[model samples]
Target chain A: MIRVNNITKTFAEREIFSNVSFSIPDAKIYALVADNGVGKTTLLRTIANIYNADSGNVVSSAKVSYLPEERGLPLEQKVFDFLLFVAQLRGMRKKIAKTRITDLLKKYSLFEFADFYIGNLSKGMQQKIQFLSVIIDNPKVLILDEPFSGIDEKNKELFWEELLELKNNGASILISAHKTDDLTHFCDAFLLFDGKSIEMVDSLQLQVEQK
Target chain B: MINSIRIIWLVAKNEMKQMFRQRLFVFLLFILTICAISDPGKENLYFMFFVLNFSMALFRSIASEKESRLAEYYISIFSPTKLLLGKIKAYAIFFFVISLLINICAVAGLLRFVDVSFLPCVSMLCGWQVFVQLLGCVFYLSLVAFGASYSRVHTEMQGSIFVIAILMVSSYFVVENLADIFGNVLLCETLLKYIPFTMPFVKGVGILPMCVSFVAIIFILKFSGKIYKKRLFYYGKNKITEG
Candidate 1:
């Protein structure tokens, strides 16, 4: 479980957000819905500890993984090697990391291209690798910012299946994406950012309101 | 403590693996090897080349990571201190090997002029040179890392690299003439030997510079680690000014 207590953030003498608080319970996915230039990415980054809040704190002992909105990948690195290093950095043993990476690649049908440099892959494939790196460790708290911006529908479906699997295993996910139709199906709740704060709304209630 | 060390090692190993494949780095190594082998009597010039080459490589590595925003990802996932240490560790190992090779080449060049019986003395001298060069390289690289962290763009870092190179050359000149200014050769030598930039050019092995270099490394890493933590997430807007 992730508990965020009245987190406030400011930058460059401007308030990005103030007094925002929410908690993500285990075994569920939450969609962060907000228009561009809003505090969606900033809020996610704060929760991931990439950016510190001006006040309050995030309390979670569970292992967390983050996928930034921008593609934060080393183009020079091969897919398998990159994922293996990330796994090891996350404190997994090398042998286990290697095996886990191999299994993931096979499952994703990327085994043949595991040795290819990430720069050589298509945009969708590269984004797929970025997502794979995040989920490789089965993080208890997964935070994603605009994770599905430029991918095709097919890959998006594949990602949703994997995210559901992770959720079933008791991981809490906070994902912000442009595609609400895709997220509305499986995401257990929606955290709507209104440029100043976040309001948590149930998925069923959100669906009824959308109707 | 053990886990921290392990994290550093893992980062270092990964960095080394990736760097080996960089075409620019391979080209730099080729040029360095040629310079080391071709220049015989100019050890000071060779040391400058060493500084320029390694510092550029280090700067390029840091700059590219920043440009690509990969540094942000690494910082988000792992502590910046461990990541920086790991990067420095890898560069230190690379610098040590290259310095050793350069010293070996210099000693080999001396083979043509020195007496055959003095080969053992030359080898011992070469060993001392390698030790001193390693220390000097680490010192300069740490400074380079510090400068690279604060630079907001590629041109800015390029300017910083040139400034650092000049500072290195100036250190050699200062250390060489300090005795004349002080009118006491022994005292000057004792004090000036602690200057890491002078370590590679010194004729004999001295312990002062080694101690000084270790302290400088620790202090600089601490200072730079703080800068890195602050600057790692800063995605500043780049704008051109009107003339």
Candidate 2:
């Protein structure tokens, strides 16, 4: 379980969010919905420990994998090299990282481009690579920010399938996006951000509202 | 400690490979080779050439990461100390290689003009050249890294360049007229001794200055690491706390 207690954040004297408290239970998908510039990314980053909250604290007992909205990978590295490096950074052994990366590449049909530099790959392919890095280690807490931004329909399905599989395996998944419709089927609950704070809404109610 | 070393080594290797791939590095290196061959006997010119080239190299190595926002990813994974150490180690290796090549060329040129009997002196001179260049590289690189850490994309490159220029000019002026400025104050003399690359050439390189340079390098590295951590991890309108 992950508990966020009264987390507050501000940038340049402007408050992004304040007194934001929530809990993420195991084996559940929490959809974070907010408009652009409304602190969706900031909230995810805070939970991932990338950004520190001003007045609150977060407690978690699980391994975390965060995919930020911005893809800041080294473009000079080859696709395989980048994935392997990220795996190692996340504490995976060299032999395991290499084997898992190879399998991931083959599974995602990226095997042919393993040796190709990431800068040469398409935007969608790069996004997929980033997504793969997050799930490669089967982290207990998966925080994905705008995971479907540049992905195509087919790749989006692949991502959803993998996310659901991870969720079924008891991963606490917090995914944020502009469009909530795509996540209606997978998310267990919806956390609505109204610029100042967040409120939890039942997934059933969110589905009915969408209807 | 072992884990940190491994992380540093990995980061350094990757950084070195990425640096070597850049066309700018290759171009500058070729130009520096020509300059080294042409001005082998002119110590000041050679030193200036190294200062400028290595300063630019260190600046680009760091500033480019900030420009591309890649530092964010690495900072999230590794501690600031590890990241800084990795970069310093990588650049140290780079400086060592370049210095070795230039020393070889310079020594060859000297041998052509001088006699074979001065071989031992030539060897010692080459070794001293590596030490001086490495010390200079680390000092400038640390200063530039500290500067680059706090700056964003547009300003980081220019900021590092400005810092290197200012330090190079100010250190030269201060070292040249140390006695005139401070008038034999023991404390001032003691402090000046620790400034790397500031000592005058005597019969040979002084042991005291070499030890001082090593200590100075450590101090600069520690100071830079602190700055990097504060800049990278704790940047917001409010105080950031770790859980």
Candidate 3:
């Protein structure tokens, strides 16, 4: 479980959000819905500890894997090598990491592109590779920002399947998505961000309200 | 402790692979080899070339990582200190290998002029030269890492590289050529004596500059690690305010 206290963040005298607080329970997916510039990315970054909050703290004992909205992958790195590096950096042993990466690639049908440089892959393929890097180590807390932006519908279905499997196995997921319909069935709850703050709403309630 | 070392080793190995893949680096190595073999008499010029070549390599490696935002991934997994130390270790090894090769070329070139009887002394001198060069390269590369972290754009990063290179080269020239001018002034002479470049000329292996260089290396590494950590977390429009 992860608890975010009354976190406030501002950028260059502009307040992105204030007094935002929430908790992500284990074994469920929480969808973050907000319009552009509503601090969805910033909020996620704060939770991941990549960005510091001005006046709050995050409490979590679980190991975390964060996928930022902007991909920061090394373009020259081969897919297998890159995933191996990610796993190792996350504290996996080299032998285990190699096997885990190989299994992930095979499962995702990316085994063929293991030797190819990331820059040479298609956008969707690269997104899959990035996604694989995060999930390879089975992080306890998985935070994804716009995880489905570049992926195609077919891969999206596959991704949803994997995410559900992770959720079933008790991983806490916090994802930011603009498309509500796509995530209505997958998410257990929703955190709606206005220009000033965040509010939690049940996914079922959100669906009824949309109707 | 073991985990930290493993992290550093993995990062350093990957960085070395990336360095070897660059055509420009290969080309520069060729040029450095030629310069070392052809101009052994001008040891100062050769040393300057070594500094310039390694400085550029270090700067390019760091700047490219910054531009690509790739360091963010590593920063997310490990502490900024580990990341920076790993990079320093990688470049230190690179500098050591290249310095060794260049020293061999210089010794071979010098052999053509001197009698073979002086081979043992020449080898010892070459070893000392390589050690001093390694220390200088590590110090300069740490400075490069610090400077590169402040750059948010390619143009600014390029400008910083030139500034650092010029600063290093100019300081070496002033110290080597204008020693007499400084010698007359007590304060200037005192400051000049601490400069690491002048240490090589001092008889019996200048211990003072080596000590100064070692301290400077530690100071810069720690300072740069803090800056890098701050930059990684406090980016995107907000100036990092001191706590």
Best by TM-score: 1
Stretches of candidate 1 off by over 4 Å are A178-180, B34-42, B102-128, B176-183, B196-209, B233-243
Global Cα lDDT for candidate 2: 0.75
Q: How many backbone clashes does candidate 3 have?
A: 0
lDDT of the structure predicted as candidate 1: 0.81
What lDDT does candidate 3 reach at residue B102? 72
Query: For residues A20-133, could you state the per-residue lDDT of candidate 1 as single tens digits?
Result: 888899998999888888878878888888777889999875967988887678898999999999998888888999999999999888999999999999888888898999
Over the stretch B1-243, how does candidate 3's per-residue lDDT look in tens digits? 998999989888887887778888878877876776666655556666766776677677766666566666566677666777787788788767867877788788778899999999998988887787677777777777777666655566678778877877776666556656555544554565577545432323456777898898788778887777666544343454533
After superposing candidate 2, which stretches have Cα over 4 Å from the reference?
Answer: A208-211, B30-48, B100-129, B153-156, B169-191, B196-243
lDDT of each candidate versus the true structure: 0.81, 0.75, 0.78
In model 3, the Cα lDDT at residue B134 comes to 74
Quality class of the docking in candidate 1, CAPRI style: acceptable
Model 2 has a DockQ score of 0.26
Q: Candidate 1: how large is its RMSD?
A: 3.5
DockQ of each: 0.46, 0.26, 0.36
Where does candidate 3 stray beyond 4 Å?
A: B41-43, B104-126, B178-180, B184-190, B196-208, B229-243
lDDT of 2 by residue, B47-137 (tens): 5556666666666766656555566666666666677778777877876776777778788877887999997899787878677657766
Q: Which ten residues in a row have the lowest lDDT in candidate 2 chain A?
A: A63-72
Among the numbered candidates, top lDDT falls to: 1
TM-score of chain B of each: 0.83, 0.77, 0.83
